[model samples]
Target chain A: MITMIELAESIYEVIKDYRNHDNIFITPENIIEWAKQFEDNGQLVLTELNKIIKETYISRVRAKEFIYEHILSYLKLYEYSSIAQFLIDTEFIDVQQIHKSQPAILQLLEEVLTEKFQVSYLPYKGFPKVNYIYFDDILASGSTIGRDLVIFLNKKNSSGQKFYQLIQSNEIKLSISVFCLHTWGFEFQKYRIQKEFNDKVLKKINWFWNYEIQNHAKFNNQKLNIAKPVKGSSSKINSYLENLSATKYEDYAYRKANTPTTEHFFTSAENRIRFENVLTEKGIDIINMIKGEAKSNIRPLGLINPQYKIFGLGTHFFTWRNIPNNSPLVYWWEVAGHNWKPLFPVANRGN
Target chain B: MKPSIRTYQIKDVVTFAKTNGEFGALSNMAAGFNLFINEVNIQSSEILYQACRFPLFPHIQEEIVRTQNPMDAKKVSRKYMQYSRQDWYSIKFKIMKWCLEVKLVQNFDNFSQILLATENKVIVEYSTKDAVWGAIPQDDKTMLVGQNALGRLLMELRERVKANVINKSTIIFPPNIPAFLLFGCPIEEVRNDDYFIVDLDEIYA
Candidate 1:
């Protein structure tokens, strides 16, 4: 006998008091527990209401707020400014505050440069560029420092291209100097090699080519003997570098190689096992064994065996005899411009 | 469109009798009468007299026949006559009240058109003047007759309508009531025993 209007009013009254309660923003476990209590009390409507409220509150509270606001700013002031100042004084570099930081690294660099050598703050229209690019600390991933460098480089090149192009054309020599605030060991080496190789390869191919090699050696620094297959032990250690799909293999082998620990290694391994199991279950005759030998303590090109020769990195063992009726690999080969293997002729038959 | 008696009416009553016919003589009599009257014209004086004269009928009629002078013939006749009128009036009032409560009677005329009963299946005649309007098959044997004999005439009316025997007349009820109230018999004597019938169009329209 209750009217729809009265039911709507009762629902509003139940929800109004708990609208902005801080307990609603408690952890997911606590929220779930509260929901269970509500359900037990025969309050199904209240349980759903509380779940929606808690989820909204949690989503509004952004993750990692302290790191963005506090830690990053402190690093820019004390560490980056001192490193920038050293770079300016040691070299006769013109340092300017195109972007500002707290306790101002660019300002400190400008002061040190004016005291040691000739320095001037360049306006947007008129700018002079000699050499040297500097940064504070380098991590395993070069993305952060690389992004900042690109922004500064773009600003320097905005006017006439005289500053950057003249330096690039070799009329004036441009040398990039990054003062190491801490040991940037492996990442620095990889970045330098990638830049040099990228420039050389671009000229020859008339296209930019970049690669990151994932060193699986970091997983277990000790060399793995591929000849021995240990029984009753985890095959995970052996095929740890094996199960990567073509795209994943390329990404891990190239870009993510520099920081393999940061990559979800376990998840990637599980995915590889799952993919291999699916292929095997489908009765694919392709090789399941990881190909190639581990050499010089590095799992090189031949170290891991692939079911298919992806990016032309490994050797093909057996081409499926039933070519036309073969699995999706045959279809892929046709799309990739490889000629279809002919059906066996009668002449090739033996008595 | 003309209405027809539901084919399930006999079966529904039979089933109701088998399930709920436990409460004593009146319930047994009502059930037996329902089965009997459905097949014969009880409105005819000859048939009603014969029916009332049955060995069991005397027991039931004795309950209705109240008299001060059993020896005086004229007084006994008047008393029996008055008893008949009172019984007929009570039955008519009870049926009318049931039709009203079930929302089958639309007006006073609708109430008059409805033929409801505890001991006979109910019927409603939408029109009074149409030819074949009062004609109905009282049983597998004889067809019903008479305009004032409400129960017999209403069944005949329904049969005529169903056979396309009457074009303009509408007959309602193999006693359609709301599904929830099918078990809710209001009459205390009949509550646990007999089935009641109402003509929906008579009240609802």
Candidate 2:
């Protein structure tokens, strides 16, 4: 059999080409070492993980293509289209100071705008006005974007109508563009808007996304296309679930017992079971090693609702910049005291 | 006597209620039969049906959807009676039938399996208070009487399933009535196996 380091060799080739992978100081050696954490299963896990990275790792080159493609699709604007006035009129939202991803995403958007359109427009830099367009990398629980948009919409302009009221009156429109979106996250965002503003304002907003995560994680869904575990009937999973704090999300604590009627996310049905089980079991072991109360949002698999009593959102999505905290912890949990090393140590986050 | 009672009375019947009985999957209140529509994860068809009552008030729809139980969804509807659409009474049957169809499409395996189990028998919703969507026992358990709107819809659904004629796309196209909405968003067409959404500007205006 190949050595553990050799097992990670192939992924190193892929990782080297992963564009925009800056500043976290990862190397091929780190990849090999990260795989060794799985010991005997190291080779198998790394191979499956390599497949995902190849499929999902959005190099800067690819992200630019995606950004340009989607922007054109949204604007119906082109290289020849009149964009000077439209650029000045759009306010790409920069409200998420609670996390680092939104700022980073805006920065990337700025670069793309300069390259693709030759507009000196810097995203998240100009005053809020005109047709509002919010840009973010991904939306998980929707708290950050929801809270941010709420603040922006409640603000009053010189005319004294609230931004939401302005939107309802058709003085301007709002659009959201993201690399990835979760169905639940979008719903939660809508719920936030409905509670704070009204649907009339919501109707003025549009959404554009490249990758859609279909893990609504509702109960009794037999075919899940996201990273959820095999059922928690297993002794370890059941015990972990039973011990969770009471939460309304307990209904989503497991993927349906019969799952992945189609394995759209993973390599295959058999491999999905293999990869998810290993990742979940490893995640639990990592959680056990936590020194104390691992924040309310932390879970065995990844991040979820603070009150959500499930394994996690099982987000398997990734980008060249960073893995979302909503992904399985085995991908991004880098606590200093923990025994396991994350495959992708997140950059620029307080975590 | 109600003139409609005889027209709706059934002798050979398969009844559903109590949510856990043999034919309970036919009840809108049954658990494990959820639906994803217009990007919202609806708790039950009852919640979806109640939500259809207030298309203009998204807040009411959210209140009903966030309720933990279906019975409470109805209570939530009654709580905001004034906000209900003016044309609700006239359009409710069309909306409820559409909600059931959505339940079948989204929860195809469990819903269709149970629906096919009824085979050729007349399906009835056993109810104590609601005689319109369901039926009331008139003579012992033998005679079930009332408008039986829900039962009639189910029988129609059963026949459609038997003949394999569901459009696979009507959940988003709900019988061409005005103001059929969830969360105030007009569902246009099924985007994929996942969601139903339309372009915003054309309909939002």
Candidate 3:
């Protein structure tokens, strides 16, 4: 049981630089005010919120060090492994083929690389290329990374050689290096890429991530450790789902929260449900505030594809750069004059 | 061999239920071969198939799906016998076959490779009591006897795998029937397992 003041202070410390209007970079008071929306469960919200901040939040320094470890130190060992035989069999690391999901992380990666590799990553094209390593904050649904790769692979460079052609030919390879990835979304992303190219380019692809969240609930054996509350858990949640546009109702979103195989992400199973319920309840309240025709992507927890129709993607991971749209709305939903203030003012949303 | 029985030398057939068996990945009870049907994560095909028995009682399906072990999931289903769908007796085998098909499609790479490894040798589910889904050791301990419905379905799956037709489908149609409901929703077609690939063992424990 954490006091609101103590929890708010710790949260403010972690996300102090979250951008705001006119010197409004988030403060402790702001955190307290936001939790009050939950009323009697306000303390519970703060308790869970504090848990999230303590366990999930990433500061700038911490993220940069991670980038160094994955891209340089860890990747070195990977090069000679059979998993990365394609990298060695083909050409040198394609240092310049950086797919930056956002400019800041790429810039952070470049800084980290320059410190270790001791070379300029940019302005050095035409080097013997083998693999492309993408650095991003987190891969929530994999749509952003998948879409980028699809567009990049389908398009030809100045030489009229499609990137997919290069990959299929084994002349070049691809690997995505991200901070964290969801087990379900990671698979879906790979599936999307292969489907786009008709399975001709998967062998050339490799994936590296420091953390993977088992948030998927498709399997009966799966215990969803992430924030998926069961339907009928509360009248409010049911009413919320029932209120959705009839033509756009998403039935798949109304699944019961499965037990996680292990309780690694949340502190405990009881706490996990309490946290999910409060956030989902508040998430619905927050979205209900949207003026009219709330965008299809606007979900209680976070944003997803407009066509997805599910309550958000329920991604809990965060990075130094920003929170992902796939995260719950309680973490990053910010709209002016809506009487709502997201503690972590997200950086890149709706891109 | 009886008309329904397909006897196989115990040494020639593959058996799975335990996670460590050579072809254990083919077992509906095996861990790590999680399926995502209709954009939902099912821990195994056994759980999903069992959950299908009580579609009208979604809460029971939810309880069944929440069980970590497939055997436990079956217990959960049994506890709610009063809520079992009326057509369960007639459609049970078809549902089991559909569930296995889902397991095969969702876990095509590993499951199919293992199914193919059986290599036309009569596949058998070694059992002592259950004759419907498995075979029992006959008087001769060297061979087995029973309906072996699971084994037959698996052999059919091996052919489908060799056929390589349904592997790419984004959605799998349910067995054409009067009604197939899971979680109170009509079963149309489930999303292909290709959408997500769980790098098991590498999976976060």
Candidate 3: how large is its RMSD?
9.9
DockQ-based ranking: 3, 2, 1
Candidate 3 to truth, TM: 0.63
lDDT of 3 by residue, A1-351 (tens): 668899889878877755432244777898898888777877777776666665566667777787777766435644543323423343323223233335666677667756766554564444555666665667877766766777768878569999899888977667777778876677566555654564447546777777666655543344454686766559988777666653322654754544554666666777777877888888988888889877766778677655454676677777655677778888777788787777677653434
| Deviation of model 2 at A254, angstroms | 1.2
Estimate, for each residue in B1-205, the C-alpha lDDT of model 1 and write its tens digit. Answer: 2223332232222121111343211111121121111111111112222222221223223222221111232343344453333344324323322322222211112222322222244432212242122223244422332232333343443354345543322222322212211111111111100111111011101
Candidate closer to the true structure by TM-score (higher is better), 1 or 3: 3
Q: Rank the models by lDDT, top first.
A: 2, 3, 1
For candidate 1 chain A, the 10 contiguous residues with the lowest summed lDDT are A342-351
Residue-by-residue lDDT tens digits, candidate 3, B1-205: 1237666778877765466688776667876566665555567888988888876676788788667578999899788888877877778788888888777666667777888898987777777788778888878688877788877888887888787755745357888666476545576666555333332111111
Candidate 1 segments whose C-alpha is farther than 4 A from its true place: A1-127, A151-159, A162-164, A171-351, B1-205
> For every candidate, what share of the true interface contacts is present?
0.00, 0.07, 0.10
When 1 and 2 are scored with DockQ, the better candidate is 2
* Top DockQ hit: 3
* Per-prediction DockQ: 0.00, 0.06, 0.09
lDDT of 2 by residue, B1-205 (tens): 1215433345678888689999888899987665666556566789988988888877788788888479999999999999988987777888777778877876666788898898888788888777887888776656777677887888888788778787444344565778666654565442222232221111101
Query: Which lDDT value does model 3 have at A178?
Result: 78
What is the iRMS for every candidate structure? 47.9, 16.0, 11.4
